[model samples]
Target: MKILLSTLAFISLAVLLGLLTGGRLSWLVRNTTALRLAWLAPLALIFQWVFFELPGMDRHDLVFAGHLLTYALILPFIWANRRMPGMPVLAAGLGLNLLVILLNGGMPVDPGLLRAIGRVGVYQDLASRGWSGNAVALTDRTLLPFLGDWLVLPEPFPARGPYSVGDLLIYAGGFWLLAGLTRRPAETEAPLKPA
Candidate 1:
């Protein structure tokens, strides 16, 4: 959720910057028309279905399966569109995240990091109930610990959160993808128009 929000925020900043620099906002939409981004729909739809009725889900394993499927699905989409701008960076982020999740059985969010955001109790409650999306109770056995949500954003933001390096790559890729739309190639003088 935070990843999506932060990506959107960056893309919004790109739009604002584009407009300020005499670029038409419409240009971004027009250029993005060529991208086959519908490949990402399942990722969104599965999550929407999960989070909408988050209280009813009793098994983390099922949630984990959905993620596995979604991330696995991204590979073919990326391969087909590898030539597109920003796709490679986006693929790198997705690959890192998928590798971590597969190795850890889920996202291995540290409890202390959750505590910093005042979200530890909520995760604790979920654990008591028999399920949790993350908050893996960080331990010696936890795999790929560095790839988890290890970076902290302390007090004074709209939300207190820990983000992963993969999130940063995704944000950068999304920003460049949109920002590239506003750029127009330099015009050359038309053979010095004879007077």
Candidate 2:
């Protein structure tokens, strides 16, 4: 899917940048605190699996699987950096997403956008085939507030996909916190050795 391709591109870019910088990349998750606290990411994902689900199997299930796998890989880094400064922010973001998901009946999709993406046929097929036999139908209008509406930005430049404001904020905050956590703390000077 396009989302998966975009994610792979992002990860490739991050790794390429890390290599080019001779391992000086601040967001590389090389420090102890970051590695340790990463556990929370996976744990949060597990919560998603336990809590979010429709009646039967659906394509949306891939979202939870992606989160679980991503955090699983990052867990070692978080565990190593358990004392890092950014865990709180990470936790907060996770909480926000969880809250929105819980409030939105397990999935955070925008039906309008889903329709725009031409998935109405798929949804109709699913319903007709009883794939979502027990699941309730949802519409964008039914979702609350502007924030609850999954409004994706139009592509700002050629070759780039759309992104939401929240996505930008989350990405910025994540990188900033990761950078701060990975950099080695400045060493204090020993009161010049007595001559």
The candidate maximizing lDDT is: 1
lDDT per residue (tens digit) for residues 34-104 in model 2: 24344556565455454333334355455445444544555454444434455445544544544454454
Top candidate (TM-score): 1
Candidate 1: which pairs clash?
Answer: none
Clashes of 2: 18
TM-score of each: 0.76, 0.49
Which regions in candidate 1 have their CA more than 4 angstroms from the true location? 1-8, 37-39, 42-53, 125-131, 184-195
Candidate 2, which segments miss by more than 4 Å at Cα?
12-29, 32-34, 37-87, 118-144, 156-169, 178-182, 185-195
Residue 115 error, candidate 2, Å: 1.8
lDDT of 1 by residue, 1-195 (tens): 765675478778977776677667565555555445544645755674574347765566777776666666666666655654566787788778777878877666767566667776655744464236643455578788888777777565555566677866765765655565554422111111111
